[model samples]
Target: MRRTSSISLTCLVLASATLGPALTAQSAAVTPDMVQTGSDIPAKWEEPHPGYDYEKREVMIPMRDGVKLHTVVIVPKGAKGLPILLERTPYNASGFSTDRPHMRDAVWSAQRDWADDGYIIVTQDIRGKYGSEGDYVMTRPPIGPLNPTKTDDTTDAWDTIDWLVKNIPESNGRVGMIGSSYDGWTVTMALLGPHPALKVAAPESPMIDGWMGDDWFHYGAFRQVNLDYFTEQSSQRAAGSQVPRPGSDDYQDFLDAVSAGHWAEANGFKQLPWWNRLSAHPAYDAFWQLQALDKLVVQKPASIPTVWLQGLWDQEDMYGAVHTWEALKAAGHASNNHLVMGPWYHSQVNRSAETLGPLKWKGDTAADFRRTILIPFFNTYLKDRKAAESLPAALIYNATENHWDKFADWPGVDEKHLTPMYLQSEFGLALNKPQAGEDSYLSDPAKPVPYLAPPVEADGGKRWQTWLVQDQRPVATRTDVLSYQTPVLDRAVSLEGAPFADLFVKTTGTDADFVVKIIDVYPPNDAEQPEMGGYQLPISLDIFRGRYRKSFPNPEAIPAGAVEEYRFRLPTVNYVFKPGHRIMVQIQSSLFPLYDRNPQTYVDNIFFAKPEDFRSATMTVEHNPQAASSVLLPIVSGK
Candidate 1:
């Protein structure tokens, strides 16, 4: 990877300014109100209110630890006995000004229905950020009852809710919490035995465990570009903080650093405290385990009604939402736990949900979601409304048919009917396993496979939001990548749960990385859309570091030239492989700057490996009756 100079930053800024309105228009055109059978109106369809007749106040709410967190509260003028909707976030809460509250924050725009319903809206800055009095702890771990007075996110949330319900005049004494991404994590933290006032929560795309499959690391493989960019953006805050130096081409910068054998020194990783702490704990040690929300959800089952909203195409924290939902269900909170999954990117539930990349849905998906699903859930629990009684335990949007489906319970492994798609020697996907054969590829670290190409820009660019659903045609031609496709499907195969890949592989080196992508191949002669006739849309993908095959906490080097079995889970997707569309699987060693390259030479800590540690390796994937390499699809029948 290489870094671009300040010039690239200027160009990126100018490009964003020029293209902002056009993109907004395109989204509006694609995502207009489409639901017909409901009296409930979509937020986008509703005419904008002239102004909020509310009394706005900014206050510093003190926690048990004596840290004052900055908070903004908006109450309807002369309104009393209203339910409270709270959102605590690391992102700046001041962005939502009371005078002009029409912002992109989902708590405001996406849930405008709540405002019309007369619930008090509140947003707060978490500790250690702008206007907050305490140091920010990234992904603050929950402090259980074992340690009293030891304040954490859980304690802070309890204190905040405790204070709000007691102190806020004209309060109904009932509260609901909701947030997406980092704020979502805060919502999950509060779910560890929520305060008495807290009745319901919706944590959308929360970060569960960074090391497993959330935002930072993917099964021990570090996500370099995203982590670096996020750290730089968040590290410096507070009034009058010095503006950081601008840099472009984060992909190139990281690649050059790793290539030059000076990863830490080149990128100045030490300066970023979170990165320093993360690098120190490479494996899933106590550092990451403490931050795992699944553990908390299991140990202390959520008593409050909770709705987990997740995007099937969420690039960052898909694992967090799904894993947390599963954990909660396993912990015997099935009746209180519900899930809503849609064809969306991270936080795109607030934006246009009708289309993602080249794929489009039937209706104004986002609008329908807000009007029918989101508002009713919160209203039922927070305000004791009966309208939400009809909501299902699981409301999943099937990308395959572009329709919503209801389930009595989540279709977990027990209910899933799996069909194995085996890899064949002729680069084909077969229902039956091959007798005996193997395919090999030389993975050169110097020329790794790009996750998306013509590479993404350094600064926060549009590709960051759209890349997960982007066409995979760019890397399909690379020799290092192995492609296998099934013949055109006679009928649609619907997948509703998690997908897993089982591979028997042999690497020439002591360690390596395996990347698997499940894709949907479109027909070439489609007259409706010629440009997307042969588009390869990735349904789900994941990376695994070979060293961690045996134990995530204790990784060991692979025995050179020895065959081994490697099984890993890709994020779940609710998609149907429609007729005429082929199901394809791609295997590759490295997905460039997106994930840090596995040096092929096993080192105690990959973060500190020298340039010489990086080496090219020959990798083989065996597909035979004995060592069959197959992708398991959780096919749903009768729908």
Candidate 2:
């Protein structure tokens, strides 16, 4: 019998060479041979390659409600039963074939690696999508221990894995789950059920939360960019249609123009049925909770060896990954988990950038991640293969130095360098708290500064005309963005974890969004490089939106022109602010499309709001010793 063989391995290789390319995991390539044409495939199949033959067949596994879900099983040929590797995605299961053009182009990530490793890989489209029978719900259902009414994605996953083990052939029984993005979420869902066969999971860039907290929502704000873009793309895919091919250049230019002012432009938003359905049930209502991954995990947590892959600059899903990591740790699941964070964005890992900022890494970090780290992790945990545990439990790529840091935990051991860096106007950012001084700014929501970290066009073309970090220096210069910094550190100040920026403030309107950003100011330099070197470290940096200052649970309209105080937590980081470099934080009212424009009206739910509901609001910042306005840096002491 013949299975899909690599184009290169075929006797008529030169003719079929067009079908294969030199990818990192070339040996793990998915080339199918002996394409079977029948309604149902037999239990066993033979292959020309004695060492490896695979049987592919469709099977309907029963769910909790007796709903049979369609699944595809890819069993390794000739080998004894091995641990099962599971993947559940909304994407079609039939497309899981390794030899497909899309998979070869790096578009499909999970299937290739595991299939190549002699593992029995199974891919299933979640119930209600594609081949599965059930009404497809976009996000997971929410029912956690803390809040017990949720019936979510985890429940569905539990049903699937429970069925797979009992029926699949050549089953050594152990199971491991791996996938990125939505597939990542599926893995997390599976972990929640804690199957005896489940040994490990790797969830990369998962959508962990749904409310105005993560992914689907922001700080009391919906994610306009993602909601509009994802709904359109997902709905199309769900309908068995492809993302419209890149149209004419003129049409592409139109998309670019529409994306320019996405926050303000009503015409740019995609109007998909799913988006409408999602908007109707806004707030952290039970509807959204059913879809919240963190809440579900906290209630029905997964007890398995887990690895989380997070991208610091991921335009989408960064909050979900980071917040999920923190939540799991807080729930006391820290010891069994590890994190691998890079300076890449959503799809940036495909090519893998060596230099994120001014720093350069040692190798093809993505490939290194796959070959050295990921493979070993699954091999050891799932296959019970003995291997060195020397690899750091956590691997983080520092953007500033562009190097990898290995540690036993997400937040490395404390190096105890807690120093209060005050925001002084004269010296920019003072290392010590200021004696007595005040900085003032007016935050106009209508004229809020655009988020400049990454530029992505939901409709299609890139927004080159708008702000990227390069164009953001001007915005950072605005009075609206209250900038405070500590003078260049005399010695390197290493920050290993989350930092808090407690602010004192007064607002002239009912509400205001306080956006805090921490920047690692680079050393002064004068070099004429193609990428622009005059501004050594003029990056817009990290930003966190602040609207529901008091609580995400209940947000009220601030009395017009009233004074209020809030604490903003900057995203976690581990970096050494080198000598002569400054640590800076900029506070503003809005992060634009990165977060939906706050309506300024202290409304209970804002997801289903309209353009008319948005109101202009004013913001102010106060600095006083009584306010004790300061940033608490989680500096690692005895490094």
Top-scoring candidate (lDDT)? 1
Error of 1 at 430 (Å): 1.0
Worst 10 residues of 1 by lDDT: 238-247
Residues 292-408, model 2: lDDT tens digits: 777667776666878888666565565566667667787887877777777665534534566444445667777667766777888897787755654566788765565778876
Name the weakest run of 10 consecutive residues (lDDT summed) in model 2: 99-108
Question: What is each predicted model's overall lDDT from 0 to 1?
Answer: 0.81, 0.62
Q: What is the lDDT of residue 270 in candidate 1?
A: 59
Write the residue-wise lDDT of candidate 1 on 457-572 in tens digits.
65336787778888888888888999999999998888878889889999999999999999999998678778788989899999999999999999999998999999888888
C-alpha lDDT (0 to 100) for residue 81 of candidate 2: 71
Model 2 gets an lDDT of: 0.62
State every prediction's TM-score relative to the real structure: 0.87, 0.77
> Which residue pairs does candidate 1 place in steric collision?
1-252, 1-255, 1-256, 2-252, 2-253, 3-253, 4-248, 400-576
